[model samples]
Target: MSAEPPVSLRELRARAEEVVTPEAWEYLETGAGAEVSLGEAESAWQRWRFRPYVLRDVAQISTSCRLLGHDLATPVLVAPTAYHEPYHPTAELGTAEGVRDAGSLLCLSTRSSRTVERVAEYAGPWWLQVYVMTDRDITEAMVDRAVAAGASALVLTGDTPYVSRRARGTALPLQDEVALVNVQQHLAGRTWSSLEQDPRVTYADIEWLASRSGLPVLVKGVLRADEARACVAAGAAGVVVSNHGARQLDRVVPTALALPEVARAVADQVPVLVDGGIRSGHDVATALALGADAVLVGRPTMHALATGGAPGVTAMLRALTAQLAEAMGLLGISSLGGFDRSLVEDVTHARG
Candidate 1:
């Protein structure tokens, strides 16, 4: 095996595939119902062409920004992903350490192999991603525990009320050893299916969570402009435009395609973040130009973790940051705030 970490996200994924078991690889790589949305998500960024300006000072490019009162070194954050143990033995703890080293934020999943308290031990701003379970008390307890464990924000995944079918089939079996430590007590004696997200969860639940927790609540999985406004009205501190990596509904609009609409609807009332098919710094630039405040990265982080553990993740983040900076410099923009809709244009419908 090569000692060096892969330079490109695509190469990193290929490396991960070589190292991990087929079952684990399938679980990470596959999306729901033929995955049309999955392919569209990454491809959507290409539809917008960048309009660069010359003869301007581009020195001192920076990717830093403040998100929900927290300073981020880069606009990139690790989107919540489940069961890291399938990729690396150190699991979420190692992922946390890696993100800390990258000077970015990490939104940990409720399905993490390590408990929130354990992952919180690492140095970084962290958020807890939650799924409101069938049991309301369990959901409340999770929010309280995550706050107590030092999470700065609560990202309520508004998608996945129920699991969707993956054409590749579910490969990773739920084993007792890798228990979801945060809610294991509440899960005791209950069938695993009981933990399936409460399909009935609604905007009222967002209100309830905001009332119960002091942390800012961000609703993820919003695709429409009207729904984005509804979440803010329901007390969401922010909204993440996502389709659960196209793992929930396969034909839903790509996050890149949906971001501008949601961002426009929210009208800066709350920060708009986006995830799904963000694989490069160019993609990050496109998202910002289209009105996203920041972008959340998922599978790339997992690929880095699988290839080289914490160090791999750190390198991947740094590489992405560098790529973003280079793109900014070439565009003659010195900061993220310089980005505007005028900087990007849809070329897909251009007539010659």
Candidate 2:
């Protein structure tokens, strides 16, 4: 382990760039066409002002929360990102061990470089992020393997019906050998892109997956309230308001801006989580105040993994959780339930 913890997220990214190839950096950082959504994601989080409550007992603030029957030390989760080997030699194994050590959860991607069983050996509480393939049988088989390997829930990524054109219009050439470990056996010597997302997948597939695997299913990449409600009606255990980290489309609403509408749509019925440009603990608190059950962090984790490996990830998660506790105390809230929509206001609409 290094003598010191990793630096701030910006520094981590800079350091990662020094060690990681330019192609890998571009694949990790850039998003779809025009990059408008990507550019606005972090700034969108900054536009919310906290309506803090004062003069209450906050000395005993707690950051603990429950999701999908598992207790978490913090609301921050590792959003499913593919091919960790590009960032770290340990691959998903290091990320899993880091998340486990930090008392957070990992949502392992269906495209992870590591196998479900191998990741389970190091991961603590984790969910399997699924991409329903052109071959339904392949998708189902993947789900079954995740179930057998001890994934707590299935996060059905609903937005990626097909790959979008990146603004750069190129990606690092990730060999199938390093990117398809989880699905390789099912591919029968075919290329990884052959396992394309099923464009025809409907809301009904959520119920079908839950029933088939006996695991709770969360629909990720939903932005519209109507779509969130539709997922719930079709038996979704939760809804993640995301634009696939702004990787799916250009100029889509950032998750911070889209969260409240989706939260109002189905938060009472199921957990509503959001991801996209969540950079700090204050951002996490703002997410909760906006009615999210939790928030997921993606690029930051990859940066940490690239720079400091597992220990860096653990340090970053701990620092965020600590910052959350501090924010809760400063906001005069003692627990996760204390946050509500009344606690935040979009600064764009504020008047003097």
Candidate 3:
């Protein structure tokens, strides 16, 4: 018989660290400043306890859900991360294929090593992540190109107006040929620093982008209830409670802790998704119970891509989904519709 593959994310990350260069590994692992936000994002999930129901008909657990009109086989999506080429030769295409195989969604970053069109060719349900450029024309053109290339929605990343300082120091510079394929022609001869996004971008831009592309807009990086509501009012189809995986801001409120307020502010008017330090199925369940309609995973997906290309990503996603289903079964919840605030208790307060 064939040997079993690694089903644990932690195991995959360890194996990936062994294969990738020190620079790449550091870039993937390090967060901004003291890394307190990064650590908190994962640990905060543990502060909540599941209050499982008994004697309910959870014989067949279904992990299906819908996000912005798209049906997802699972509530998880591969969150947009930059420069996949550092992880594997196939880069975003390999990641796309893995997400497709897992029957999940993918959010492709504008900084991807491959063009949006190329990645779209391999993906299933996909969204295009955009960092509004200092150059308005360039930003508009990118949005158009992604929509033309079959992106299902536009995920406007709002938290990274300026790059953060990483506590673990910088990675080695990317090679000249390691271009942002989607916008390389427009950026020829310019340093990556020249691509710095507009720090002053506002809600007006979100409205303009929605009008320009006519695609559903999801404003990522919102932590406050007011900000979440503002995004929706400004034409956001969804709001993602994120702190750029706690990479853009240090000591920010963890996304897990921030999700409840944002979710309540949006109040079902628009889907609320989150991404931070989610690493397991229990994390996924915790997000849902706190009011996240779906969750996006970044580091874990990158770790999987680094280890085994498309197959590793598929295995990682499958493992997460399986764990989620098992958790639902144990909680006596048969479907996502059954998830409610009552299912979770904030043990952090109770402990005090």
Candidate 4:
């Protein structure tokens, strides 16, 4: 029999933990070093107090928006997380279908177990998240394949030169468990160690990737205003203010805290997005108020997929969108454009 659907994100994670193996659970939950950044990232959103307007017409609310020329039913997008196969039998296909059904979008990871072509068959509007490897050919080939397979854009992960030392170690044997179907043939008898992310990657590489693939590239893992500005100068089509989900570094600034500065740096030259610790529609509104064009949810998507596969993911996306619409109505804002810095204020100190 299928498992019961989750009623809350916390419950959803609890159910997923019950089914996922101990090692996989640790791999999924733990962060680098002391995990300080990981723990703080989630709570950072709560510091923002919404300044809602009253007496405004809220009879019609629309959460619809466009990103990089693609229309979305909601401002929420599925952030790229690797190896969905371990979470469900359907894996990325399940995620693709769920996001498509919800009229949202998916960002497929480079380390995905599913091939780009296969996912494209099941996905709606999608983008490819890339990790430039030691073997640049492998990265380029995959990007070319994804472009051919219908990827609308490329999201280049700027953090993570190498995987950080997580607080908890796991014995999941990722070499065997991960199919890496997208670039397996390109392995060319090379050692797995040889394929580690190239630490030498720089701003110039960002321009190269976009020019080579003929697709707009959004640099992810940015936290500073200067870095965001550099990315735009280097021809990045967008900027994602993320701390690599707080997995790459310990004690780093949270995306919520970093977003406004990064957004201001770009000056709307490109779309700015924020992820990490986004839990509800209120947080979505908070992010937009802080200058994000949209928000991305990572772990919750995995939790939902693990519990009930495609339906679970679809339900989760729909629930969040519904909450966002409700939040818009309650805030007396009728559209996505209504969100601004004026809508939120930092209440970290005056909470009393």
Span of ten consecutive residues with least summed lDDT in model 4: 1-10
Cα-based lDDT at residue 195, candidate 3: 72
Error of 2 at 335 (Å): 0.9
Q: Write the per-residue lDDT of candidate 2 for residues 49-157, one digit (tens) a residue.
A: 9889999998687888998888998899999998899898998999999999988999999989889999999999999999998888889899999999999899999
Off by over 4 Å in 2: 1-7, 189-194
Q: What's each prediction's TM-score?
A: 0.96, 0.96, 0.95, 0.95
Hey, what RMSD does candidate 4 come out at? 3.1
The collision pairs in model 1 are none
For model 4, what is the alpha-carbon lDDT of residue 57?
A: 92
Best by lDDT: 2
- Residues 1-352, model 3: lDDT tens digits: 1123327777878999999888888988898899988888788888899999999998777888977788888898899998889888999999999999988999999888888889989999899998998777778888999999998899998988898889995664577467556787777566665577989889988888889999999998999999998998888999998888778779899888899999889958999999987888898998998999899999999999988899888888888888888888888899998888988889976644
Off by over 4 Å in 3: 1-6, 188-194
lDDT value, residue 123 of candidate 3: 93
lDDT of 1 by residue, 245-298 (tens): 888788999888899899889947999999999888898988999999999999
lDDT of each: 0.87, 0.89, 0.86, 0.87
Q: Which stretches of candidate 4 lie over 4 Å from their true place?
A: 1-7, 171-177, 349-352
